[model samples]
Target: MPVPSQRYVRNHLLSILSPDDYEAIQSVAEGVALGRRDILIAANKSITHVYFLESGIGSEVAATPEGRRIEVCITGPEGIVGVPLLLDVDRTPHETFVQIEGDAVRVEATAFRRLIEERRLLRGIFAHYAYVAHLQTAGTALSNGSHTLEERLARWLLMCHDRVDGDEFPVTHEFLSTMLGVRRPGVTTAIHSLEGAGMIKARRSHVQVLDRDKLKAAAGDSYGVPETEYRRLLWARR
Candidate 1:
């Protein structure tokens, strides 16, 4: 019910906008609290609003008719939700939901569409973000297809850690399994392996990064390319 402070406006895409461009949309943007597992964009449904996360993580998931789900990409303050709207689409087959509780700045989809059309810089920022999202999705596909469970889990943890404010966050084996499209036992085993290697410490319903460098090593080449690309495209000038 209260207004979000300027400090809460940490979404990278929004932050990179020129001051004039940001102010143009600020009047229409409303802050909202997002709860864990909150559905932001439902598959096959028209998107009503687009969210620029101020904190926490969102998962873009792909589902099959058999009710199986696999995460295609993870977004946080570094990205935006409702990407299909940017591509001139009204709906998508992929669903997006909050993987952790956080806050976001939201704008009506129509307003957002209009704003981008009227502002070249804003439109360019969103275009860059969409390309980064594509790279992240591609990275996920490569990880899922080629990496080991432990390596993939490490990569996921590194991604989450980059988005959160601290070294630790709450996550369960079941949730990890669903995100990774692996069995629960496989997630458990991977968690233990990371913990044993001192790459992370797992507790009840949480995981903490102990040695990020080692974790990156465990993730091998699956973790850094998209991150480097994001920084190059979006954050370098800032």
Candidate 2:
């Protein structure tokens, strides 16, 4: 198969690869369209492929036996979806799915594993990304335990904004509640609070960031730690 042109590769993780490393796996990579709610990885299921998002967002979620699900981390173009593959695991305990409609570059799991084994830099990058992803998960846990609902909402909005293209993005109270592990009423109330504060504009199924600085202020110390760590670990290395 023909390799995709560099100009067409928007995924930050793929873009940062050295030319040789990028080409090493390029022939096996295929572009795919992702829909909202598309399951990329199902808990305990053997992963068939690994995805590098070109746009949109995905959520890593944990579920209870009762089927209650809550997002543990959000991934965008900056990261890959199949972390278990990098860790030499065939299945993951958590599920991952697209939160927004977008496109991705996907490669068969076997091909990806072969590339990782052959490329030292690619292996190092995946390891670094996995660490960054873990930090994000830890930050989410800490914020949920310590921060107020409004503050957590602010932090989530900021994270979403960083991944999306513009000030506005498609989201809903139900979705927000699911991601934050809160009730819908609580998310509704928090949205109103942020809207009243002029930090954001809430529409029927979307939220627009009006003032990111104010949003960060609302989030307090619950936000930025993981982001800073990402820049330090990945951007510096890049």
Candidate 3:
């Protein structure tokens, strides 16, 4: 399989790697396309391969026996999906899936583990990302519990906006409700609220961000800590 060239690698964790380090990993990696609803990691199942997403969005979701699902974290090129591989763990309780269609460069779990073990920088980079994922989870909890529905929606959209390529993206009331752990009607109400405020434009199955700064103001303090920390820790090394 051809490894993505250094100039073409999109995964943030992979792109910032020193050339020699990048080559070390790329030599073992192969690119795979991921589609909407593709299950990347099933709960409690051994993760066989780890993906460094080249483009698109993935979600860390938790579910109940009653079938209620809520997204706890989101990742794109900025993050990696399989962290259990780095922690000496075989599986995780959370299920990860692609929220939007995209592609990734993946390597066997054991191979990745070995590479990171032999290289301290790779290990530290992933560890730092895990910390950032944690902070994102904390932010989600704060948003879900304390913020109003409209504010929560704004925060969620902002996070998605960070992951994709452009201002407009495909989304639906059903998807938003599932990710937000709310009823479809409630999600629709929030969407209208934001749209009316001119922060976004929502149509049948897509949303276009009209004013990101305004959206941030609506999300208040719920959206930036993890992002700021990502810049501080990851970009500093880059």
Q: State the lDDT of candidate 1 residue by residue for 1-238, as single tens digits.
A: 4435444568877777787878877878888999999999999999999999998899999999999999999999998998888899989999999999999999999999899888887888888889999999999999999999999999999999999998999899999999999999989998999999999999999999999999999999989988998899888956
Better of 2 and 3 by TM-score: 3
Candidate 1, after superposition: displacement of residue 228 in Å? 0.6
State the weakest 10-residue window (summed lDDT) of model 1: 1-10
| Residue-wise C-alpha lDDT for candidate 3, range 148-212, written one tens digit per residue | 99889999899999989999988999999999999999998889999999999999899999999
Residue runs of model 3 more than 4 Å from their true location after superposition: none
lDDT of 2 at 112: 96
Q: What is the lDDT, from 0 to 100, of the residue 171 in candidate 1?
A: 96
Each candidate: what lDDT? 0.91, 0.91, 0.91
Question: Which residue segments of model 1 deviate by more than 4 Å?
Answer: 1-8
Between candidates 1 and 2, the TM-score winner? 1
List TM-scores for all candidates, in order. 0.97, 0.96, 0.97
TM-score of 1: 0.97
Residue pairs that clash (backbone atoms under 3 angstroms), model 2: none
